[model samples]
Target: MINTIVIDTEDMDVKPSAVILSIGGFAFDVTNTSETQTAILQVARDPELALYSAQAFYGLVDTFEQLMMGRSVSSETQQWWRAQGEEAHEALVGERQNLATQLLHLSGWISQHREARIFFRGTDFDGSILEHAYRMCGVECPWRYNGKRDVRTYIDAMTRGIRGYVKDHQPCFAMTKHCALHDAMNDAEQMTLAHQINSEMLAA
Candidate 1:
């Protein structure tokens, strides 16, 4: 009896009362006025935090490369790389330290809301990304299959579930589209898809 119905961000409707959930560059704008009254949940990563982690990892790799190449480390490059590494280290450590607190907050948020649906991009690795972010934020997601490797299967299951829900509930018209994972979609394209899905969902 899963009451939540999660939709991809690109499929969101732009209704006035829609709950918007934005994570990374993706967003879910859900119309909450349906008879079911599902809450739209958006899970977004903090760009600054992700950037810090990436910079740190990249710096360490580049430093090791420079060392292997026998190139003298310029003072400027050394300083810049060291700073990036430190920033990343700090960000990661902070996230780990706060993991518990973040999870509690997420659990609370989900429990408080009636119909809670999570939206993100990429059916392959997005779940892992969300899990890592949640860990950093001190939250433990009760939802199973919230990892990157499980996404493909999870999506397949979701599609089947949606299909069944539509058939049983007799929605006007239900539509599902598969997009490239992790690729960026232009604003126009995203908006168009969102509108199209809304129209179809309403028709169902």
Candidate 2:
């Protein structure tokens, strides 16, 4: 049984060191050697409520080529890639390096604080996507693996796994689904609600 660790996030003068991340990508297919395409990655830093994010998209040219060969991708996705044209891949040259550097830097900073945590909605999905990206870049994930936290797990535990409970009470910071940046920001907001719920339950 997992226990929920709640804190008084609202009244605290000094915020804890943490970050929330979200990734928008193709369906997670472990069997696929290509490891699915990661469309975007977003990060929301806590304490200062700062957003230190880097956005990157890869394989647009390859996707476009595939579509030319009559790939059966969704019309929306195919149109989006077609709109980017063949030069889409070259336009974002070195973006992967930039993304990896930013991730490495954030991981390094978080690792400096023993209690710092990295929060994501799903550890298996989001965390694995991040790990795969880092591996592709030949960069080691600097933060301790134990520091990785699951927002969904914490929130579910706080709400006793009641569906829609968190959604009803949580702040409406997320406006768009399937968007990494928006989802990451929303997760940070949801964490505050989780803390409040846990605190109230404890008080009662």
Candidate 3:
């Protein structure tokens, strides 16, 4: 709801690694709780990614061969995904295409929402991967770093500011729906809801 561009990235490597597997996001207008079209990237799948299954698939290893272009894998992270449930597992696999082509599509989306504040759960991972992709294609990053925001801080603060409480209930998408595109969509929807809650709190 806050004129946000919610984003998420699936990476081959863990921290300090830009080997992103996919990027997905969408724009949201907090004013009307309106959402824009979603943007998703499909990179070239790598066979080597299959080796990390002993630890865990995380979305990258399980979906690597099915996904698009990406960097090397992170064994530690792979184990984490392997430990997740089927719902989370299902979220990793998605449509596939070349990294360049997918980025081109993502680039256009970013451009359209250039003025909006870009939000990512882990800006270090998601934001860095996005910049790396644009750099790889020799395209300028559509949004300035200053305009980019972190979802964790904003959501936590807003929740407390409004004295909001999270209910003990099932999630809209099970843990299996933790894929890159779906996660991005989820973040956007949460922000939209947060904006609405904030508005109501202020009005009262």
- Evaluate residue 53 in candidate 2 and report its C-alpha lDDT on the 0 to 100 scale: 20
Q: For model 1, how does the per-residue alpha-carbon lDDT over 39-127 read when each residue is reduced to its tens digit?
A: 11111122342223211000001223323433233455345435553433332222221223433534444454344344333443334
Per-prediction TM-score:
0.29, 0.49, 0.68
Candidate 2 residues 43-137, lDDT tens each?
22221112332221111112233234332334454455445534332333322224445556545434444343556565654565455445655
Model 3 clash count equals 12
Candidate 1 local Cα displacement, residue 96, angstroms:
11
lDDT of each: 0.29, 0.38, 0.55
Lowest-sum lDDT 10-residue window in model 3: 35-44
C-alpha root-mean-square deviation, candidate 3? 8.9
Task: Quantify how close model 2 is to the true structure by its C-alpha RMSD in Å.
Answer: 14.4
The number of clashing residue pairs in model 1 is 17
Off by over 4 Å in 3: 33-70, 92-95, 161-175
Give the Å error, residue 46, model 3: 28
> Where is model 1 poorest over a 10-residue stretch in terms of lDDT?
54-63
Candidate 2, residue 65: CA error in Å? Answer: 15
Steric overlap count per candidate: 17, 0, 12
